[model samples]
Target: MKLLKVSGILLLSSSLLFGCATMDKSTSTDKVKETKNTASEALKGVTDEYRKYAIGEIEDFVKATEAFTTAVKNGELVKAKELYGPARMYYERAEPIAEVFGDLDPKIDAREGDVPEAEWTGYHRIEKGLWMENTTKGYEQFAEQLMKDVNLLRAKVETVEVTPDILITGAVDLLNEVSTSKVTGEEDRYSHTDLYDFAANVQGAEKIYHLLNPALKKKDKELSNEIQTRFDEVYRLLNQQKNGNGYKLYTELTEAQVKELSQAVDALAEPLSQIGIVTEAS
Candidate 1:
């Protein structure tokens, strides 16, 4: 009898402990699921907001391209030159979204020699003619094609599926665009309008960060604040180089100024890179 009683007590204790362990495990699993769901919803909201913003930028880009191309086709060299930087600014500010349409991006914005000379057409081709060749003659065909391509981009962006990865990667890519080409003054080599594109790229990345802020803050407020601070610092540095309604031409910038801007962008890029990981972890 004693042995039986002792066996029964041991069995009951084991069952109770097992039940508690199972309950704890189940509770932890539920919490993780809840966290994941929250993160997903937050990211969905960010993407939706970004989609609306991207559509607006492309709409503006289309209008600007219209005016710019019209000037080029009419042989209004001065007007075309004036419009070039501002018009490209719209495209630069929303480049990642524009890039979604693959070949259209290269067709519309490819630099000189980016493609075969036989196949070359778009803004840079016109840019070279305006500044290097010093005439808009012979550019009428390219101007018309450029306008058509930008309009198509506007139409295609309506169907773009904006997501967290797109936003995050795009933000990073914009910074990279600045660091790799715009900062080096190679993008607008003929026109010397690299600063305009550089500023626009930063603005676009900032917009992405703005959209992602709420979600990111939820996961890591400190990081969100740090990124914002860096953005402000970069913009402040850029402002020092501004000239009137536009920025000073890239050629006018001293090497030290370029280096300062490059360093600021690098500083911002480091923290901005962490945003995706934090949001995904949520």
Candidate 2:
């Protein structure tokens, strides 16, 4: 009888523990669901805002490209040179959205040798004509093609679905563009307009960061603050190289200036990379 009584008490304790465990699990699941809902809600607002900003930039880019290509078509060498860097800036600022349409991106911006010789066209082709060849003659057809490609890009961007993952990846890719090509003076190889592209890419990434900042703060306040600080540091370094309307041409930059700017970009990129984890958490 004693053994039976002990067994009964042990079974009752076991059942109570199991009941408590089940309740705990249900509460945990509810918390997980709640977090996911909050993240989704936050992303919806930011994504819409980012989409609007991208569309506006593309519209501005189309206008700038029109002015630029017209100068090339008319064989206005000086006018085209003056307009080149500024014209490309708009496209650089919203490049991630442009890159979404893989076909259009290459056709619009591909450097010489990036595509087959006959296939190569767009901005860089015109760039070499103006800077290396020292005239816009023979580029009128290329100019016309560039205008067509950009118009197509503007049209296609309207249909793009802006999502949180896109915002995250776009921000990272912009920085990567700077670190890899812009900093090395490889992107604008012929024109030496690397500064224009570098600044524009940073601005694009910064816009994405600002849009997601409020949500990021909710997830990880410390990290959000650190990223903001890094951005400020980068901008401070870049501002030192500023010239008139544009920047000091990349060819004019001293080796030390390049190293300083590269270091600042590296610092900013490291923390910026961590942002996706906070914003994308389930």
Candidate 3:
């Protein structure tokens, strides 16, 4: 009887151990599936949000550029000058999407010397007419072409898809754009509206950073916080050069001020680069 009782106890112990192992395996599998589902949903949300933003910004660009072209065609040079910076702001914000359409981007925003002189019919061409030539004469054709290109951009944006990789690359491109052109006062050289482009580019990049912050924070809170802090510092530096609602002319910045801004941008870019890696890991 004692031997039989011992045998029953051992059998019961073995069953409990096997049941516990099975439960653990099931729980781990469920956790992994749950994690994957959560990441998928988050990625979808990011993509959807960026697509909506791109569409709205492109529409706004169309409207603003239309107004700009109208001012130029009407021979209202002063009004066109005022509208120029603001008009380009919308384009700069949605530039990444516009760039996907190669043929249209050059027609709308290409700088002088970027292509053949004959092919340089865009905002910069009009910019030269307004600021350098001091007249809107002979620019009506360019203005008309610009309007058509902007409309095309709006139409194309409606169909374009925004992916996570694009968002990441766009954000980096924005900073590089500022560093290469806007910071050097080369982007809006004729009109001296580089500040407008610089600020707009920063805003564009910041939007991407803001959208990805939640996902980034989960992967590396320290790096995420550093990026946010650096962004704030850059903005603060920019705000010091603000003239009411807009920034001061790019030419107005002192060498010291320019150097400080450049450093801030570099600092931000360093941490910003990590976002793609963190996001992929998550």
Candidate 4:
């Protein structure tokens, strides 16, 4: 019973870490071809040893995260405290990648309530305020959600189904999503508090390029244009992000621009998140 009550890892950096799982489904368009060619291509470029190195590190982090989240959820306040450091290390390991891409590190800072806007970018100042006031509880709601999410994926990952019909151009959009989602602090800065999302995003995006770039050349000009168009759209939204303002960065964002930004982020989020950092048992 205590296990059920335990909370999540409370990692703001890994905030959107599991959010991208929804990307596993297919896009409506017929132009997308499902292919593992990218992964195969990547295999040649990267040694299996390297894959294990990256993938193993992430798995270890997730396990520690699971323990911490469970303790928090159980309200075993004592147990939860003990797990914080190990849990925090998971985030720390992946920080460099996340920051390089422009993500807000929970280890570094995030916005919370009552925290002055000026002190906004510092370590979850507003988060403490929110918890104190019980306004926006940090990952209070998300703790257990990902446990089920990961359990489901664990089984699926062992024998992941791949097809040649749905080729993702690459997972860069996913990395871009985690990194740039920081434009607005509201998307769950604390969620991505650690570097897990950043690592997964980078790992996943590289496969996209590694797998699809060759097939892209065989595509007709129109198909290439469409792919280019979609890719560019994602790029523009990522680039458009304010230092950390997101939509708020706009002096006066029209409803249209807001919608575009949302759509842009969503468009690339799936591929990167779904298959970004898959691992097979050695």
Each prediction's number of clashing residue pairs? 0, 0, 0, 39
TM-score of each: 0.89, 0.89, 0.86, 0.34
Over 175-241, each residue of candidate 2 has an lDDT whose tens digit, in order, gives 8889888999988899898999999999999999898787679879998899999889889988888
List, residue by residue over 130-172, the lDDT tens digit for candidate 3. 9999999999999999988888888878878776657777887
RMSD of 2: 11.1
User: Which residue pairs show backbone clashes in model 1?
Assistant: none
Give the residue spans of candidate 4 off by over 4 A.
Answer: 1-145, 148-152, 165-210, 242-254, 262-282
Model 3 accuracy (lDDT, Cα): 0.81
- Candidate 1 global Cα RMSD: 11.7
Model 2 weakest 10-residue run by lDDT: 1-10
Q: Candidate 4, residue 243: CA error in Å? A: 3.9
Per-candidate local distance difference test: 0.83, 0.83, 0.81, 0.40
* Per-residue C-alpha lDDT of model 4 across residues 1-282, encoded as one tens digit per residue: 011110121111221433443344343111122223333444444333333333444466568668856765665555554444344444333332323323234323334543455434322442242334433235444455444443443333333222221123224444454446533434334333222233334444444444444434343334445545555675565455433422222324465765675565555454333322231100
Candidate 3 segments exceeding 4 Å error: 1-38
Task: Indicate the residue-level lDDT of 24 in model 3.
Answer: 62
